[model samples]
Structures are given as C-alpha cells and as structure tokens.
Target: MTSGFWQKTGKGLAKTRHFLSAGLGSIFKKKREIDQDTFDRLEALLIGADLGVEVTQVLLADLKASVERKEVGNLETLRDKLKTSLIEILKQVPVAPPIDESPIVTLFVGVNGVGKTTTIGKHAKRLCAEGKKVLLAAADTFRAGAGEQLSIWGQRAGAEVIRFPPGADPSAVVFDATSAAMARKVDHLLIDTAGRLQTKHNLMEELKKMTRVISKQIPNAPHEKILVLDATTGQNALSQAEHFQKAIGLTGIVLTKLDGTGRGGIVVPIVQKFSVPIIEIGVGESPEDLIPFDIENFVGALFEEENP
Candidate 1:
C-alpha cells in the first residue's frame, strides 16, 4: 500500500479513532490498577462504539481474563491487546485469491442507496487500470435510470456496458452480457443488479433467478457474489447481510461510507456474524477512494498506530 493510502485511511477513520482514544484516554490517564469498575466502564465504552453487546462482552472478557494472567498491565499495553483481539476477529475471513480466470463473472447485490453501482464502477476501473478488458452487465432494469447510471460509470472506467431497455428482464441482460463477455474474451464481467429490499421476498427471488441465468450461461459463472453494504447503517447493515445470505449466498462484502461515521466499528460484528471476507471499503467519493481492505492499515488507522 502507498503512504497516501495509509494517510487517507487514517483520515477516513478519524471519527472512530477519536471515539477509541477518548474512551481509553479517560480510563487510563494515569494508570493505578485495573478494577471491576474499570472493566464495566470499558464494556460500556465499547458497546457505545457499536461493537454490539455480545461482541463487546466477549472481547472485554478476554481482555479482563488476560489482565488476571498479567498479560496486559497498563493502558498502553491493554490498548495493544484490544487491537490484537479485534484484528483476530477481522482475520476470520481469509484473503481472496487473485482473479486468474478469463472473463470472470461477478454479481453485485444489496439494497438501494448502499453504493452498489458505485462499487461496481470503482472495481471496473481498477480492473481496467490493470489492463483487463472489462464489461459491465446492467441487470438493474427494475430501477429507472439504472442503465444510464452504469453507462456513465462505464465511460469513466473505459469498459463496455451491456444493458437492455428500462424494465426489461434482468435475466436477459445477464444472458446477453455473458455471451458478449465470452465472444469478446473479456477478462472480467461485472453484473450490477438492481437494489432489492431484503424483506421483499419476491424481489429476492428475482435475484436468485438472475444468479441462475448467469450460471447457466457460463459454467461456474457469477464466479463472485459480492454484497455491497453501507457502513453508516450500523446493525441494519448486518441485518442486510444476513437476509441477502439467505437469498443469495455472498462470497464477500464491499463496505462503503466509512469515511465519516464513528460506526465503522460495525465492520467487526458484520464479519463475525457472517464470516464474509470484506473485499474493500469505500473511503471517499472518488474512484480511487475505493481501497482494498487491509487488516493492518484498517486497525492502525482506527487506533492511530503506524500502518504495518
């Protein structure tokens, strides 16, 4: 990662960093001894950071038990311990392998307004920059202007976008896009699906249909099913992940809008509950703002530690 990447990540997580430093700084300004009250207050602070009650309790228990064993003595050491614990939880999802297959098919899923289309665009740009011939499938015909939105992004990313008339069958779009990808021998095919509410069973079933279409068109196609989530949504994002997993199993997640929210800690519970590898995080509005999820940079940025 570049130095700018680390700097931007630190800036993106400034809100959460302030939250953590403030809570810990107050508790351990001049360390005397760890006590029951200290533990209780620590639990409250973590819970307030949107770690979720269960996860906070689990982490607090681990840290307190370590203190009993004399593993962590002062605030600075305890801070390091907490950082390590969080990183362990984040590491539950392993790193993804490089895209090696020709015309790799990827499907993007999520509710509306979660930056689903934007994530697709940013990734398409990255792939193109890598000299890959990328094609975008606008399978989001359900929404007005969805096709145009992707077309704009395609122009910016220097990729061709496959689409149909507004309100056309989304399956048809995927089928045609797959055929184009094969005929052109493109390196990657990114399908941008319409945003569907999880509670709407019919809409979710539609997503399943589209998934089937992609697989039928190309064996082992839709090779990647990525769920795009809004970080600012807090626990609501986790609920979205759960509901989408039931509808269409997610292979990974793209967490967006982390630049300005103290709720970035929500990433911990999302990964813990779903075990979904977070592919990347949207830190800002630019195409380059979409940075790959690096555990060290993420933790370091959030805690103001040197990027490892």
Candidate 2:
C-alpha cells in the first residue's frame, strides 16, 4: 500500500519550494556574469537560505566554474543544474530496506526532544497499516512517562509495545522485545531509545548496550540506526549530528519539525558535511505527516512557484 508522506507533504513541499524559489530566483534575475558581484550575491543568498557555509562555498565554486564558461545562462539551466547536483548528492543514500521480512529491527537515536519517540510511533503505525506485524520497544527508560507515551502509541497504531518500568535497564527491555518479536515472528521491531546529550557517556553507553543486546537475538539485528533531528534547530542540527554519529554511528537522519519553521535548508548542510542519508522528514505532528526525503520532490517543492 502507498504511504501518507506522498499525500500530506504538500505543505513541506511548498515551504521548501518557497525557499528554493527565493534562492535560484535571484540567480537568473540579471544577465549571467563571472564577476565577484555575481559570486557574492549567489553566495550570500545560499548562506542566507541556511544551506550552511561549507555547502554554499562548494556549490558557489561549481557555479563559478559554470559561469566562467557561461554554461549557466538563465533560470531553466540554473534550476536544472541545481536539481541535478542535489539529486547526485542525494542519490548516495540508499533506499530503505523493504519491510517484507520478519523481525526487522530499527534503532532510533538523537538528542532530547527531537521527536524520536513520535517518529517511532508513526513508523509503527505505517508498518501496521501495511499489514505487517509490528512491535515497539520503549527503551527510553530514563525519561518519565516515555514508556506510557509509547504504550499509547502502541494502542493508537494497533501494535504491541514492550516496555520496562522507568529507570529499568534499557538493554533488558530491548532483549525482551527482540525475543518477543522472534517468538511471534513479527515483521518489524522499532526500538525507542533515550534522548541524551552526546556528551553524556552514561547515556551513550546505554545505546551501545541496546545494540549489543539486539545482536544476541539477531546478529547485527538493529539494521537501521536512524537519528532524529529537529529541523528548526538549524545549524545546531549539524552539531548534534556530528556528536550522535560519532557516538552511535548513524545510518540515517530523520529531520523533524520541517512544517513549522523555514529552516528546511538544514537538510543541505547536514548531508553535505556529514554524508548521513536523510531517510525521512517530519512535516507535522499527524501520524501521516512524516515523509520520505525525495530530492526532486524537495527541490521541485522548493522552487515550483517562482522564476527569474
């Protein structure tokens, strides 16, 4: 069955399109030039667009080369070139594994309050609707009410939730959950991890334990380690990504809160600097609001309305 992202991402698409339109819209305003003024304008626009300094510089350097050769002339060529470059960059992220197999485990990690738990719930619901047997492990045992919240989501999503009392050993919960999943032959096992600062060794240790415990049941069972990030955090998102990746090794990133703020450009720098695959974006709070990251749809959504 088709997912909800393809349907409700229109608003996110619009937000992204609006930003992209503003960025590329200016590039074609005047006759193409190889002068420093042209370079400065483009650079400033991208940086202001929140693409980050490094990404802006790299993109600007490439644009400079094209301008010197007069390869980028008008709006059409500029838009196409931008889209192609972004697509090439995004193509590096492999498509997520299909969920047809049983007992697939996904470990969710990120800093506090990045919507990690909510993302897990949404994912569980989606998998359930697809007719897959899904289970949720509330391994975020350090936080108060985290277990109950996940249990609520379990009921809402119609999936079983395995949780321990607050302050219980998270690894034990995961160990039990994995065993339950295997015994039931479930399709997917999504583990909700604690949201701790990357600097916290104890919390990071907990994550490593979660991974180690899962390995016991299914070798390298946590097939996907998704880092959920707050898009509204902007550049702070990059720092969080760096720390989280270093600590637990992020397999992908889930950018949350894209629907509220205009800071969607965080996607560019996060990918450019870290090379972490952006698997999904949280546009809004609805269970259906999380969208798979699509470069073209994203770029098109960012620039659909305006032209130079």
Candidate 3:
C-alpha cells in the first residue's frame, strides 16, 4: 500500500478510532494514578465494543500488569500500551500474498445483506485494473435479482458474468463458468454464491455442492474462500463466522461497512480465534472502496487521533 492508500485507510477507520481512543483516553483524562478503577473502566469500554469478555480480559490483564510494574502511568501511556498489545494480536492474521495461480478461482460466501454481491464487483474491478482477464460466476441463483446485480457489476468492472436463471442449480453455474474460464484462458474467476443462513442445513449442502463443482471442474480451483462480513454487525459477525466456517471453510474474511459506526474491535476476536486473515475491507460504495487489508495501517489507524 502506498502512503496515499494508507491515508485513505486511516480515514476509513475514523469511526473505530473514535470508538476506542475516545473511550480509553477518557478513562485517564484526569491523569489520575493508574489503578484497578482504570482497568475496570477500560474493561467496560472494551467489552462494550464487543471485543468478547475473554479476549478483553486477556488484554486488560496485560495492561494491569504493566500498570502494577509502573511501566504505564498516564492515560496517554496506557493508550500506547494497549495499542502495542493490539498490534501483536492484529498482526497475527496471515497476510494474503499476490495471486500466482492463472485463472485464480475465488469463492465468496456470506449471509444476505453483507454486501456480498457488491464485493464481487469491487474485486472484479480490482482484477480488471490489474489487466487480468476476469470472469464473474453468479451462482447465487436462489435470490431475486442476484444475477442481474452481479451482471451490472460485471459490466461496470469490464468483466464478463456467467449466470443462470433464478432457481437454477448453482453448482451447474459454477461448472459452466469454470469451463468458460478454461476455454477463454481467463486470469481470474470470481464465484459468487447465494446468500444463506449459516444454520440452514439444506443451504449448507447447496454450498458444499457448489464447492464440489469447482474442484471437479477445475483442478484445485476455488483457490480462495472469502467470507463477506458486515463489520457493523459487531458480535453477531463472530457468531455468523463460526457457522459459516463450519459449513464452508473460510480462507480469508472481507469486512464491509468499516467506514460506518461499527466498533471494528470485533475484528480482533475474529482473527484471534479463527486464525483467518482479513484479506480486504469495504469502506464505501465505490468499487475502489474495497481495499486490501494492511495490518500496520489498520492498527495505526485504530489508535491514532481521530482527526488525523
């Protein structure tokens, strides 16, 4: 990421910065001696952000130990300490390397209203910008307008979209798209699936069947499985991921609406527990708004002054 991209990312994280920094800084605004009261207040703020009680406890324990050791005194110092610890946790998500596979296959999974369809368009735009021959597979045949929505994005991104009618077999769509990708020698194939609840057993079976078609049609295809999550969902996002991971394995996570008022702290527990890298984040409506995830910039933005 360039310096300009970092600046854009910092701006995108403004809401989260305000949420965390403002709350943490207020606990020590008076410069009072750091004590259990400080930790208690900090605990409340972190937990309120839906960081998960267990993870929040771990973070608070570390901070409390630092305070007892006289290493952290004022609120400013405590804030820095928390940021350092958070960086350690945030950096644990494995960075997604550049795509090396020709006709690289990526399957997107998520429930409805997480911007899954829009994300596919953004990704297609990115691939097109990179001069990759891209094709979109709209396998979300169950939903009304899902195919048309993807087609509009495909046109906007300058990528061809292969889709079937509503109620059509999604697996057949994947198989057909895979065949087209092979015949056309495309550089990237982005597969979009129907949005389904995590606990819906029949929908899960449908997803698995789509996965089967990809592997069967193309060798080691569907190289990446990314879950599109709405960061605004907070704790519910974690719950959704648990079932999605169980039903259809996830290789990476793409968080949408980070530009909104979402606490954004939820990313912490998701990565800390699932071990899945946050591959991308959508901050705005434009195709260009879905930017690659940069741990350093994200951590820096999370703790920096909101006005910055």
- Best-to-worst lDDT order: 1, 3, 2
lDDT of 3 by residue, 1-308 (tens): 79877877877888878888788778878658877787888899988776788789889888889888999888777778888888898887777677677788999999888999999999999889889899999999988999999999999989999988899999889999999999999998999988888888999898888888888877777889899999888888888889888877899999999999648788889999898989888889988898888887887788887654
lDDT of 2 by residue, 1-308 (tens): 13344445557655656666776566556656447776787677677667788877777777777767888866676666667666666666556566555678999998899999999999888889989899999999989999999999899999999988899999999999999999999888999988888788887877888898898789867888899998877788888888878877888899988887665777888887788789888888989888777776776555555443
Worst 10 residues of 3 by lDDT: 299-308
After superposition, candidate 1 runs with Cα above 4 Å error:
305-308
Which candidate's TM-score is highest?
3
For model 2, the local distance difference test gives 0.80
Clashing residue pairs for model 2: 16-302, 17-301, 17-302, 17-303
After superposition, the stretches of candidate 2 with alpha carbons farther than 4 Å from their true spots are 1-7, 23-34, 94-101
Off by over 4 Å in 3: 95-99
Model 3: per-residue Cα lDDT at residue 30:
65
Question: Candidate 1 at residue 233, lDDT?
Answer: 84
Evaluate model 2: give its TM-score: 0.90
lDDT of 1 by residue, 204-305 (tens): 999999889888978787889999998888888878999999988988999998987886888889889988888899988889989988888898787773
- State every prediction's TM-score relative to the real structure: 0.95, 0.90, 0.96
